[model samples]
Target: MPAVSDLTSHIGYLLRMVSNAVSQEFARKVADEGVTVAEWAMLRSLYGGDGIAPSALAGKMGMTKGAISKLAERLLDKGLIERTGNPGDMRGHSLSLSPMGAKKVPVLAGLADENDATFFSVLSGEEQDRLRGLLHMLIDKSGLSTMPVD
Candidate 1:
């Protein structure tokens, strides 16, 4: 076997560590706002769209439908989202941010911007763009459409 120093380190390991740290920090920052990271993501997705099917949202978020349903239920309980019967498909339902939720998305979006800047402000604009491109490439190559946490 090759020596550790000579062996290539797996990008997945590093990505997981960094992502977890960022996620944890973001969660802490937003906890007082009464939204979990996952919930925030769902809200963000619906911020502008008229409404989306739960199944479609699941696919868009790269999560299982069960997970999406659970999150949707929580948001409903919080009055952060409203669910309605889909006219196009009676068997399915659609979701949109509630009036309060609609109002809060922009505030939450600002928080998200701050969180990103807190972590990435060290990089120059060019470097930040390059890093984003590289990360997208890695995700594309790895066939990863959703965020990953370890």
Candidate 2:
């Protein structure tokens, strides 16, 4: 193998490291809010849209139905979300944020914005846009439609 240089470490590895760090921080910040990162993701998905079937929500979040079910149960227990029988599909249910859940979504979104600013504000506006473009390109090139939290 050729001698490794600083650049030889590859963008993928660097992106993964940065991603993991940011995710960890977000998880820690949200833990006390009575939701995991996964749950928050689901809540965010349901924030503005009309009710969505659990399976559809799972697909949107790139998670398994089982995982979505578990998170939904937790959200239900916390009174942050509710499940209603789907009128079109008797065997299926749709999820939406309860009034409380709807209320919390914006708060959580604000926190997310704050977190991003805190961590990424060092980058200039152009740099941030460039980074987002590059990351999107990498995702497209890598065929990564979903990211696993685990």
Q: Best candidate, lDDT-wise?
A: 1
State residue 87's C-alpha deviation in candidate 2, in Å: 3.9
TM agreement with the true structure for every prediction: 0.87, 0.88
* Model 2 ranges with Cα > 4 A deviation: 1-8, 147-150
lDDT of 2 by residue, 1-150 (tens): 897768537876787787787888878878868788877888888988889998888788888899888989999999999889977878988899999999988887877787888889999999999999997998799888674554
Superposed model 1: Cα runs more than 4 Å off: 6-10, 87-89, 148-150
How does candidate 2 fare on TM-score? 0.88
18-49, model 1: which lDDT tens digit per residue?
77777788887667789888888999989888
Native-to-model Cα distance after best TM-score fit, residue 122 in candidate 2, in Å: 1.1
Candidate 1, after superposition: displacement of residue 19 in Å?
1.9
